[model samples]
Target: MCALSSQVRPARSVPGARARPETAHATRALILATFAFTACFYAWSIIGPLSPTLQKHLQLSEFQTAAMVAVPVLLGSILRVPLGILADIYGGRRVFSALMAFSIVPVAALAVWHDALATVIALGLLLGVAGASFAVGVVFVNGWYPPERRGFALGVYGMGMGGTVLAALTAPRIAKPLGLQAPFIVAAGVLVVATVIFASMARDAAKPAPRTGRVSLVAPLAIFRTSARAWALTLFYFLSFGGFVAMFLYLPKLLVGVYGLSKIDAGSRAAGFALLAVLGRPVGGLLADRLDPKHVLRVSFIATGVLAVLLGFSYKHMVPLTAECLTLGVVLGLGTGAVFKLVAQWFPDQVGAVTGVVGAAGGLGGFFPPLVMAMVKSATGSYTIGFLLLAAVAAVALSVVSRVRGDAR
Candidate 1:
């Protein structure tokens, strides 16, 4: 139901009209939008790398820390759909800049108010602004590329998701040396700079040739209602992107508690897991472009399921576990890229809304696994049960994927 001014204007009959500005403007917008997303997401995920330090300093339990980590993700997931809608109705340039600017306040507060639990929770929820940034990027980026080339363009822009790796690799070590609050101040600074750059430089392509038929508020609902394949894609994303986010959030804990790694070592390991995905993401998109997105989804789900199960068994053996985590990271990253490629191809005209729906599904998928691990660990003091459950979710996703038939869309 949301709408934006058209990006591509109809050609005028008048001779020598300037048309080149549109192309140059759109390219700059894409770069700025990408930068904004990377910074916001980097800040959003810093909690993962800093969890152990936070726990030790604040004297918090595992459940409390897990809840702290999940809060922004949950809020962000819930808000993405609406934000996407808002982007479409208003415009991505304004929405994204404002959100990024607003994120700085809470991150700055966290820098100064480090010891208060209520302060942390409140700040975490506000950081969901980072999560909301994804929708804006999707709408913003999708406007720039033509339909046939969109997969690669979005996939390239999708590299911004790996901002989590920034947190994973640096937060623990940086916070350790400078004190825990320092990273937040750094994150806040980055957000403010990113916001200014995005607002000043980013521009939207003319909105897609507007659909002639009325776009209902229920337009996206029609996707779920009419396309069985939509749900399959949702499940596929749940397994792929969901697992990606969950692992990113929880990998520090897994490293420290399950493997007896030091906090710094755990952050590096978690960084390895997240950093590897950046390459896998674009590769997945390339594969989807060359082959069938559905087939890619099926194989990814099955392979990721097997690897996750193997990882559970490998947990006790360090060498095997490391190999399993690496494999899991690559497969999930490939799948994530493939799923978004399918979305762009499948609903070319409705990329904004479709991206919103799929993006939300991916976020929701990311939300549950950490909570599952938290509950499982709280009850049994082990992650095995949780890993097995993820394996089961993957199996279900793969099974469901088989029933849906379609081309990329």
Candidate 2:
């Protein structure tokens, strides 16, 4: 583990002195990777806000509409592990560019094809690669920083998750004006640009020491078994990242359904929630560095449970409810950054693989909230049950953290 950890850590020149030129180079890499990865992730999540418009245009039922939007995320969850393996073997620079280029085809196809279900499912599969970009960015950025400084650098990269903020904000407005296909066309063009930039400028560590042989498929499973810390972090990440993605994809629908807001209005409010949460992400990481990560996480989950319950019950009072949701978003966002910092600390060697395993679980974690919402609404004709469940889950996560050792983070 120590040997593998060194391979991912950047080579340092001065023991105690700062070098300006090297700093500039690393800063530039960080900025570019953040933007590129952000655009890719943003494109991955564009379907949620646009679903209602597409449904209305095609005269589709609610169930059909939900499938179109949710299936891509489900696919994305499954793809992260293999994508992480690819990054481990080939390096992020090559794999990220190739995947982005490959994504262009399906995105373009969505632009040209008018068939609703077929287009959505096909494009959704293609876009799963974008979620894989998380592994790409992590491996890329981790190569630029030492283990001690890695949390902040990766925290900033994680902040690129703000891309979902951009998507939540703009997808509906853009789709409304230029029609459904325009967003895909623009997303594809942006991807092409990102691929070109990454190909030309991105750097990797000198070729990794030759592996003994291909690692077994059971490697990640074995790591999971040996490290109780990994499981705890996984649960925490499930609560934080899971809540973030779920809200990103479904908040617009929640707003429209419960609050009786128009699609445009609901989208804007959802965007506001995402934007606030994005700002909170880096703050969370920064806090982890100052306070104990376990403590930071404890507070985050507790606040999340409280806010989630408040928002869940707030449907009766729309004005105050919006404020409550914004608060929940911030708490969940901060929790996400802190949780990743914990991962970096515990599984330093398997950052990419661990990130993939934890991330895939997080994605699966994301899948449930929407389904729960649907089921509860279907059963009780209200979202109250779903929000209560979210609160309970968060509370359990908080309790679990209290039992975990403080040094793990």
Candidate 3:
């Protein structure tokens, strides 16, 4: 068994040396990277909050609506590996800027052609480029910070996921007056501005070892083969981050369909869930720095599983249902932060490659739950089955955590 006792040691400063420029660079990188990530995420998830509008306009069934919302997640999940490799080679500035630029085309295309269902789906696939930004930002931010501080730094960067909340809250409001297409235009505009700022300001930290040979395409797969810990972390993240993504995307739909909430009200509540998760991430990272990550994860999974069961009861009372959803947000957020802390702890050298594979798993984790929820609703005429499935998955993850040893910090 691989020991998980390895902890990142603090960097020692040279005697009487003040590296003010380096410190400044690290701060600037973290901020810019976070901004870029937020913009990309906003673009990637823009379609989700607008799903009901599209469903009504296109007269789509539940399954078709779910598929439409999920298309960007599919490409986003698969492309992280290559994008991470590219960030490793060309640096995040070029790769992230190019991704933002490319994403603009689809966002614009969707704005103009959304009347056609086929066009909307096709454009959504292209928008997956925006979702792949997570991997690029992960490698970029990880490279900038020291191991001792990486968990917190990455967690702060992860807050960019609040872009989903931003989309959920704002897109519908924007669509109300400007038309359904206006939200895409707004997202594209944000990307344009972020792309410019990122390209102009971002810089890669000096590599510890300079690259000499070409980067192998198969490097991520090779790393995956060698690291049992990577697989473990991947599974944990698949549950943690995946569950968060799935819920973030699906909450608006759930509120609208089950409780008959207005779009604005549902978006506001969903945004609250996302906001708590976003805030919890940095706290989870901070806790991992002080305690065993396994313990943190144990608490997280247990809480998540229990809450999911409560949600499965499908309370008609808005107060109980909303409370359950928000609590899961906190557990999931912390779980996500702890998982990445482990990534940086266990695989510092292969952060880029491992992050790519693991991030892909996280994205894939978000991709399927909406479809499952739709199918469950179609077959059983209720969402109770979907919530039960989430509880079951969380229980299984909790069991896996207990069996895995050597997770001390």
RMSD for all candidates, in order, please.
Answer: 4.9, 4.6, 6.2
User: lDDT of all predictions, in order shown?
Assistant: 0.77, 0.75, 0.84
- Estimate the lDDT of model 3: 0.84
At residue 278, candidate 1 shows an lDDT of: 72
Candidate 2: tens digits of C-alpha lDDT, residues 1-409 = 3443343333322222221223555676788789888878777877777877776777766556666767767767777777776666667677778877877777777778746677677778777778778776776676666555666777788877787777777777778889888877877787888888877777654334455776665565567766677788778888888888887777787777666788888878888888877888878888886777788888889998988788777766878777888888888878887877777677666766777777887787777778777767777888888888889989999999899865543
**How well does model 1 score by local distance difference test?**
0.77
Give me the candidate number with maximum TM-score.
3
RMSD of 3: 6.2
User: TM-score for every candidate vs. truth?
Assistant: 0.90, 0.91, 0.92
Q: Which 10 successive residues of model 3 have the least lDDT summed?
A: 1-10
Off by over 4 Å in 1: 1-27, 207-220, 407-409
Tens digits of per-residue lDDT, candidate 1, 180-237, equal: 8899989988998898887876665543234465645455556667777666777787
CA deviation > 4 Å runs, candidate 2? 1-22, 212-217, 406-409
